[model samples]
Target: MIHSVGNACSSGEKRVRMPAVAGAFYPADADTLRETVVSFLSEASSAEADKEVQAVIVPHAGYVYSGSTASEAIKAIPSDAVYKRIFLLGPSHRAAFDGASVNNAFDSYATPLGQVKVDREVCEALKHADPVFTYVPEAHAREHCLEVQLPFLQVHLQHVPPIVPVIIGTQDLAKLRRIAQALQPYFTSDNLFVISSDFSHYPSYEDANRVDKATGEAIESGSLRKFLDALEKNARKGVPRLATSACGQSPIAVLLLLMEGRKDLQVRHLAYCNSGDAIYGDKDRVVGYHAFSIVKKAEADAFALTGEERAQLLQIARKSIDYELARKTDLPYDSTKMSPALQQHCGVFVTLHKGGKLRGCIGNLIGFLPLYRLVANMAKLAAFEDPRFYPVKESEMKDIDIEISVLSPLRKIQSIDEFQLGRHGIYIIKGEHRGTFLPQVAEETGWTKEEFLGHCARDKAGLAWNGWKDAELYVYEAIVFGEEK
Candidate 1:
């Protein structure tokens, strides 16, 4: 299903314009670049794409420094997104400029892969907002700020929506605020907002990590004032070039302001890397790249676990296991053991216990199994195949505990603000081993959300201490039940 829609030549075969930078900046060969892009996008999961994403912040450095990270963000984009226009904003790294300059080309932006159409309607609307918004091809022509992201978009979205590429050079907060505010009404799941800028450019890998982490935390918290304060603090100390390190600070500020109206802001860190992490490996001076998606959080499905329902689920798991193990036959439970409507959804987990100790837990994150069948199969696996314990001795059957979590399908969460700590269970898996605990697990363990995830990545997945960032994470709710106290 992955493909590059356009060819190396210009729009149609009627005319051709050569790649402006070619090998100097991006890959010269269309096929090589296509393959690289495919690999990157493939790494992102579309499971959450059914939920509309509000906006995304990605780095616009050369593909090598930021490509992989950027790919993660794009891949995370809900495949079902029906954006009509893409408003791309990036900080000007080229010659000094003032105001917002839109790329004034009738022709689509030509890439080795193909041309991405310009959204004339959006472009025209923006120009009408402020006189400073002028048509300037010179500003966007060789600008890697906006150009680099084009191919990534082309590779993923079937509909190549028109683009409004803006290069930010002036640091006038009022102007930037006005521009973002004006454009805010235009943003919807059907419309996309792209902000491009790298963080902590040319800092030592260690220092870049520290400063960038601060910036990222600030963004996640949705505190524009704090982010700006950090920049101001450094500037006040006569820290020359420190503000320059975060080149896209203005664009980020605009995004922060626009997102203010939205209460739900889950900024998922898709990928992050610097030159030091690249295969080419330049640790001495590194440019930090981060890709994140912001979206409005949909209200989670409301399911109050009635005492009757809890009792039914526990009995079902126990009987299902006993029937299979002892009677060597299928257990006949109520046809509505779990809601059929819920089964049609994805992301369910089953947990089994014996003598009040953990036994086996298994789940299909995307919700392939019906709620009832998922519980049945998982109960068996937890008891016999968990690998953590000897086969649940027949004698231990009386002491086993069973819990089933009928999870609400994961919606692509736009904002972390939507996440309720005690309401969601988290799972982090990468490579072979995986770590997961139900939502109640965190409450029981007295761990904060971050601490719980970190432990799951480290202790459960057997990954490095900070492995959560690179891990595949799925968050869900559990209809949990166990032996009555």
Candidate 2:
């Protein structure tokens, strides 16, 4: 759920960041600004895509020069779509720093369009997470890059969600990656990322086109090395009248870093032009503008079970554990009464926690038996056979909470980067040894992705902390549920 910034600053002094370039960059009047943005969007030739557009890289020059191109890119974010919040990532044109800055003081930012609320909660979260994120008031005070995009969003979107305005101030690549890591959680479909940048600044019209094309293609490649090399390669050519390839390169790098190794996204070049293309502008010196959309592929649930099915499985697990406690040799089940879903084969893990401490947990990586049978067997094994703890006592069952993890098939991961923390469980296996931690382990431990793998490799797999680098790594997701009480 989203909390409005108004409520956050209601008791405190209300602070609004008034637009710094409303009249100079875009229309000063709200109606004129609305008309200009709407016209540009309507004139965009880029067809609305079928896939979900998660992010956009657009130019942030004055409306007369880059407005059309920016509109072309913003169009990719469907007008009817709603987001939890929009993160406006732009370069710090006025101030420089080591990392990005989040708005800590502002309640909202005002444009000719209206006041766009700032997400205070998100800002606080980032600030507390790491030193890389902090309040640099000077960085945001008069920044025009993010300011210019507010109107386009207000006009095109049906409802403008609260924004988390971030100014990327670092030129250091490693710091950019750290900034990306901090922002990764919000880089999902529920949120939108607007990367404000202008390409090929102060170059001749012809040279701007040539340079911008290479740079845009590099961004489209979604390879960090290629993107950075393209910039370096462009500089090597010593194109006359060139100042910088992309003024917003820092923020763009942050976006590229966040997008690293993501295979499900398709980047499309929406529109391209330059200030030279503008009637009021000249060809001698031009700033190129390009709009690109990062679209996410459709996703389907890997596995799903009905509410009744989940209840039945839990009952089967509890009964199986009870039978084991009573020293029963066999578990009796009526196969004819079982649903088809229960008959499907899948790996399972059953965990027992007594008074919030792990008592016993055991699971199988491969399922040769039906799901119902697997759950029963795993439940019995977890309660009585886990090596880390003694068998669960029958009297303790009343206070023990049982959790079941039903897993999808294990997939051999090409890179450890593919193993998302808090989402996928990783299994590291060397020739004679192997170990795995469930997906929830990351949530429970609050470990970074690297730390998660290191622990699994060292402690769980009986290998070195960096042993996963050489060992074969596989990842899997689970539909985890626990007992109601």
Per-residue lDDT tens digits for candidate 2, residues 21-75, read: 7778888888888889889999887676445778999899999999889988888
lDDT, candidate 2, equals: 0.83
Q: Worst ten-residue run, lDDT, model 1?
A: 1-10
The reply for model 2, stretches above 4 Å from the true place, is 1-12, 49-51, 298-437, 440-485
> Each prediction's Cα RMSD?
21.3, 16.4
User: lDDT of all the models against the reference?
Assistant: 0.68, 0.83
Error of 2 at 432 (Å): 40
Cα lDDT over the full model 1: 0.68
Q: Which candidate is the best by lDDT?
A: 2
